[model samples]
Target: MGAVTSSMAAKFAFFPPTPPSYTLEEDEETGKLAMSGVPRRENVDVVRIKTKRATDVVAVYIKNPSASLSVLYSHGNAADLAQLYELFSQLSIHLGVNVMGEAPMLPYIVVRQVK
Candidate 1:
């Protein structure tokens, strides 16, 4: 039974032996790492949110944020901020709303209960 279940789980699992794409490296000058391979835009603000867990959540905010609406983007596991930077920027401009995109991570669901 265990063997059969293990085989079934492996057949349906989405784990990859290696990273799907994108490589992260530290900058030689600043020794800071950022998502590369995408065009970096100016005038974007970096906002960090501190969680109760003591982890800092980082996001990028486009210039001239809208007063009415905003978007909090959580990218898929196989993607990163570098890849979606342009799309988010365009969305902010086209939708006329501020966009906050969080970096992608291991696949998991985020459920926030309303008060």
Candidate 2:
């Protein structure tokens, strides 16, 4: 689809499920990052880029990547951005690069990365 309206963008930007906050709470006892009962790290930011084609939008969750580029994809093939968290974490650890994510808006710079 084409670009969304400013009104719609504002609505989703302030939606309950997705907000403009970068919060990662690490457990003092466990020394791990989590939100509620789930691990919070390197999760993909799913977007609706292909809303017209009805295909899943790609969101590459990479460690403090220097840059991000686009990739052409067919209708039914896509990777689960969230599911690759562990692997992305490993990549960051090995490469010694900070990891961040990009969805509809822009590539977010992770202020405090996961250790």
Winning model by TM-score: 1
| TM-score against truth, every candidate | 0.50, 0.30
Model 1: per-residue Cα lDDT over 1-115, one tens digit each: 9999999986667343244233444446654434435554664654445668766554566664454788888643333555567888888889888887865332331222222
TM accuracy, model 1: 0.50
**Top-lDDT candidate index:** 1
User: Alpha carbon lDDT of residue 103, candidate 2?
Assistant: 34
Checking candidate 1 for backbone clashes, the offending pairs are none
Clash pairs, candidate 2, are 63-98, 63-99, 64-98, 64-99
Q: Which runs of model 1 end up more than 4 angstroms from their true locations?
A: 1-35, 65-67, 75-79, 104-115
Q: What does candidate 2's lDDT look like per residue over 1-115, in tens digits?
A: 3356877876666443233233334445655433222244454332234557464333443434543432222322222234444665666666655454333322331223344
Residue 90, model 2: lDDT of: 66
Scored by lDDT, model 2 comes in at 0.40
